[model samples]
Target: MVSFGMKDLLTLPITIVTGVYTALKFIYHCFLRPLQSGNSQKTRLDQASLFYEGQAGIYDATRGGLLRGRHTMLALSASHLRILRETAANKRLVWVDIGGGTGHNIEFMDDHFPVSSFDAIYIVDICEPLLQVARDRIAKRGWKNVTVLCQDATVFWLPEWLDGIDPRGSVSFVTMSYSITMIPRFHAVLDRVEHVLAHETGLFGVADFYTAEKQESLIDRSIGGLDKGCGWFRRWFWRIFFEFDHIFLGSARRSYLEHRFGTIKSLNGRNHFLVPYLVQIPYYIWLGRSRFRDNYPLDRSLELEYVSQESPGIPVEDVPLTPFHYSITKHWRVPYFLEPTHEKFHSFTRVFTPEDSMELIRHLEVSRDDSVLFVTSAGDSALHLAINSRPKQIHCVDPNPIQGHLLELKLAAIQSLEYEDFFALFGEGKHPTFRSLLDSRIAPYLSAAAYQFWKRDKNNFSSSFYLDGSAGQALAFMRSIFGVAGLSKDVIAFCNSDTLVEQQPIWQRKIRPVMCPTIAFLLRFGWRVFGIPPNQWKMLLKDGDVSAYVRDTLDPLISKYLLKTESHFFHLALTGHYTPQCCPEYLTRAGFERLRTNKGEATDAIRLHTKSMLSALRSLPASSLTHIVLMDHFDSSETRGS
Candidate 1:
């Protein structure tokens, strides 16, 4: 047994008292303290200085849990700077951090980007205490290139401007982390920001508290149709709660920011670390470029010529540009169709292709010079073509915008994810940290509409990305039927079989008798779940009855190919997931490695078009495409006279 002495008996009580005192001190400084008790006429600077005078020592320690998305904002800004620097390598890069408290963002940014790479950096703030702490940090870190300016953001200027050097349109980057809400004249500061940023290459990044409602009509077309709305209760509650601290959480700030800049990427997240209550606070991170039309660096004349399909002598100012022409991603996806109201297919129709991709590859004989056009059904065939042929370009056309979104998600996953994460997301059909990965890794490459769609439906991966869509529902129903009939073991065994001699008996003895009748019944009554329309069903009926059709389809597939090693389509049907040896080529290690090489040049070769196949074909130049794979679309078109 352990013995306790007088010193040990007193230690627990002393430590408990010290802990309680610290907790109360933190709570009092953060929440209970008043800014100005009796003077209501104090200026913004006076109020800010008095409020932060006592809390400056503990600000970093106490606010680390409350301030979320700061590092993410810094990371995104660093990425944009790297890309922008490549274009303007000869120019000097300048950065400005507005309302930079204690130089935390600049210090943290060194982890993502070298602070010495910039020619100059400025930290503008109004509070003296915070500026003193920032000066101390700069001295300790020995950042000779950094300067702290104890001035208001709206009237701040660089040292070169004082020497008559005219520093306007010279800054390369500007950032505000949780500081926009504290400024009384945010519009003036934003105007100042726009004036100082470089003409075409400047980048603006901001992360702050916000509240908004879901209003589709208010979405800005130039921002790629991004909607970051919260619930009604959250909108009202956070707005009222933040008023006590003189921090505004209304939507006006975001709206003004969007109006001032052309958005590149925007993400919304919740900070759930408020101790004692654990209430979620909403925050957002936004990145953008200059909004002036004249500042756009892309070739407007060439874009107009391409859109008109004429000679390259058209005057850009004479033609009115559509929203699609101003795409920041420079991809072919149309934003108007990506809206939820215009969606024809809310859920995916096919999880995997029924046509043999290897057979199609052999017959098409694709080459490096060939450009193939095909329907984007779950993106499996396109991946196969990209890996095998290494084509110059592949145009993926689909009427439903969700199908294009699905393909975009897969491409982004291929470009960013490691092989294990890629296998877990696609092969096993589920992942635990999909939302985190989606925000951090996969978001930079996707369009705003695609990012928003996945952000809203990220829970699909939490259960099973392959078990939530319409086709997956059908598979789920079939799985339930197999479970009821005690055929689950045989289904597993059929997928695990080594040879045709072993697979045929299990199929004939256990699965075939139950599967054929069910498929026949579903074909007659409920075939839409299988993505077969009335016209396609009529085309199928022209050959034979439903029972004979089902028998013919299953017998030929099972007789010709082994289920375990040869056919991944049927294996997925019997079992809801795929194994390493029996899966799509893109999901295999060798295929993934091939696509991952050369910084994802193969994935970049594919362009997505969200429109009808006819419209997509009409837009392309004649004789430009070498191969066109219609799959079963020809049958549907002939039946409908399209």
Candidate 2:
């Protein structure tokens, strides 16, 4: 019901004209622009200049949403550089940004690491227009350490090298943000990168659009963890879509980069910022170091010295090198074959160790010189060893891959989580923000398998991580039995008892008579839930009746130690969770602080192996272990034969 006047009619026409003009301008400058063809044999630089001449001014505004992972790439590089700076405090730190258009990446880096901290910063690109914009940015920021270079990335050199002095192995960091795919002859550029990067401390970071095949080689899968393959449609669609702008998204670029460097961390993601977030573009961020530097030969005398310190009688030279000895991160975990038919163990078998860890620590007297290896059952023993004794090294071996995943989650929680969050996760077995913490903070330190496992099963923490495993199910069964028999109050009272004297009366009057009989009968059918095989059950039967064995074990633990403050094993069994006063040592505030201090020195010393104990021992260097806590596994004849 509205009528337009002459001014309103004119305003509508003007607005329409402005919208059309802006759209045409953006399309012409970004997509429809013609290349400068003065000569048929134009160099790569000439083409790059022509492409950016009209788009440089509007580049940042137009492409801001399209270019993803720029910030993540820079932040990851900064983290590695900060770590490297600790070791090379006396040396000058340099950074080179290849194809760094308009100095946007350098400016964004200020949010993560200050730009002035670098001794020198260079922005190398083939486009003069972009370099000019970068120069303006540097001047506006008043940064004397920054430089804008209009040169090809392959032939670029530091200013010091121009004086006829070779500056090989001097640069500390090199980054390529969304530029590797645009470069012609990227192999030569990658080769030149190795020549200029420091042999030992250099780090290379890159993020760009890529297309991978549906299947990759075994070697690629092993070396490049989490670098997954793309679907056929996506791989084909993005490659053809980007080729119109002369940007190549082939898989060869990423493969060659991995071949040239040892991968420290690699992540695959999708860019979903285009076309109202419906179109997804595949991309990757890679952090790497020199492969040659990582695989350098070990000193024979030092190797023998380390081995003989732990085990004096074995010869070092006789132990051949295994694949476990050579890893990019120097961790003991290696790629192993996963059986297709095997059903994975998705929960903890033992909620707590049957063999007392405190008693083991007291008797074994684990010292700084000792290197201990033990089963990673529920990760209690290894964590106990790591906290109670700061041993030189601790190896956690388990054939069940999910068990290894659980241990990794525990270690990562110790490293990245605070005391309160740690308590909520392991003590109460429920955390609300576990998914967010796992994605942002914990993903970087975990392996691909571990990360994927936790990502899928993160909801386990939403209810109760302890209540989802087989051991948890068994505990639930026991609690249900207590509820039906109206003995839950007595059990709670027994766990709350301050001294053994208070516990003995409660156990003798109400708990033992009911629990002992029920346990003896349930032990036969429920042994598998507790991870007890038939052979182990048979061995238990050889000594005495199940009722007597149950009575003997429970009576001593209850009669000797205070249940509320002294014993976490029976406490967790009685209740579904542990109290702050009665829990594993690693769950204590002092223990968590000790493990979290000094960049997690205690947790860092532990290595996880997803293999049999015998296989792990065979792969280890001769005499590298000082103590071996086989636990009750040696009680099984099958294990003893192995």
Candidate 3:
């Protein structure tokens, strides 16, 4: 203070400026720079440590703003832990938190589930600085149970690190809180976690960012719609954007977890009000239990055998978790497809028999004693078999309740309505008095559920009921295209052509040229509208080219069966009506007599089912049916892997 030179006086201002500049740079890199993209100068682990080391003092404060769903995840974890604790009160409860940086997630959960709930809490991280910060936070909280250890989460099970904990899957709960995406070998880490988790008591909780690719099937799309996925473009954009920060947002992480465990609670949420790029960061919170359970045994052979013997006649509610039930419920809380609002939208209004029922009967050597399992789609093929082959029993099955309802309605109509009314409704594809008939004649024979379903949609019968359901959409689309291309007249001419030879030429020359290319394009890009899911479309083209499959295979087949024969199906496609000479067996005079005269026998012989084909088969005693008709069940291109 007493002695000052000219150089000393100059250094004071420079020192102050330098300190302020360094502070500004530190703040920018810790906060603002993370939000922006940049090339990484170090390894991923080193880079993560560097960012955390610099921001550790402000980590908890800064994270609360940008990171979302922490509270929700903690609540979910606490709920699961509470459930597990009831059963394992006497056992030593160990919770392992992999990559638990700063001990924040654990400390936050303490208020919810009490730190004393667990016998031991292992907070594992590779970064010593982050672990040091976690130790300080835990120490301040005075949680004697929590132990902070600096170790690689992916390889923490080394002999030196296993301090007397049971080696054979003794961990009760494991959590990875927004940390997996940063680890380079995350799969390896997950694999290790799965092994360490208690076989019967383990619960895993995770909350992290993820991006889902576009689903290729209608079922998949419906699922995605329920899941709240940001559409394909946004998902891809976010995935790439987050990858720059060594934060992976791929589907693999979530899918792997799902494969390893049974989901208990899962939710996908987006946080807004941040900057534009960070606004829609997709984070998911998931709670899952290990697939292994003490209450239920893994072996399903006994259950399968039981179902194989006694499923057919058992009440649907009484049937246990068969393969079919598992398929229907695995992805959704409820059967969304079977809900009344969605049911009618996807129903098949008219029967379009692509395969010749008479030919199938001949090939299979139809006999009076044979029992048949028929797929109930518009009830055309089953009715054909009933009339022509007259098999002893026909088990009509369809997973779609709407399709079964349609078949039931047809059966009720056959039992009650006279020949002319049946012909007008089905053969001609129109019935102005359908609602009157349904209430007066058809409703009496229908099941209570079916009756209710029809009563709600009685308006559908007033107009062209044949053109209302999803099956008619393809025909409607075709008609629109024909109108656009000026081929309506040509289509009529082809349908009107008398001889089989003349019909093929008319189809080849006029119809094929116009419709084939358009159909191919639609099949490739817009098959979903036609009720052809991507998986089903892939199955269609599994053997060869789509266009060639249509041209060489489908065209010839159609020419032989539909164009040449009295195939009312093609007539409906062309004119939306069926003539007397070209109609299903149910519309024929002799067939109608058999159904009308013997209503009880007809009803008894044809057992209509509104459940999955496999499930229906399982319900019935094994060897109950001599013949099985899968129909278009195998149309899906995507298999189990897809």
- RMSD vs true structure, all candidates: 5.8, 8.2, 20.0
Clashes of 2: 0
- The worst-scoring run of ten residues by lDDT in candidate 2 lies at 319-328
Clashing pairs in 2: none
Candidates sorted by lDDT, best first: 1, 2, 3
Best by lDDT: 1
User: How would you encode candidate 2's per-residue C-alpha lDDT over 480-543 as one tens digit per residue?
Assistant: 8889989999999999987777889999998888788877877877877776767878878897
TM-score per candidate: 0.80, 0.72, 0.45
Report lDDT (CA) for all predictions: 0.78, 0.76, 0.66
Best by TM-score: 1
lDDT per residue (tens digit) for residues 1-642 in model 1: 999889988898997886677667777866798766433424667888877888787778777878888887887677667767867889888889998989998888898789999999999998889888999999999999999998889899789688776677889899998988877678999999999898677889898998876744423433424446788998888988888788899888887887677677777777887553468798888887776656443334433554366434555554433233333433535444334544557767776676778788889999999999999888888899989998988988888777887888888788778999999988888889887677666765676667667876647678666766777877788888899999999898888888888989988999999899988887787788788866778878887888998998899888878988889888887787778989999999999998878877787668787777787888788999999998877654654454
Quote the lDDT for 247 in model 1.
Answer: 86
Residue 589 lDDT in candidate 2: 96
Ranking 2 against 3 by TM-score, winner = 2
Candidate 3 lDDT score at position 4: 87
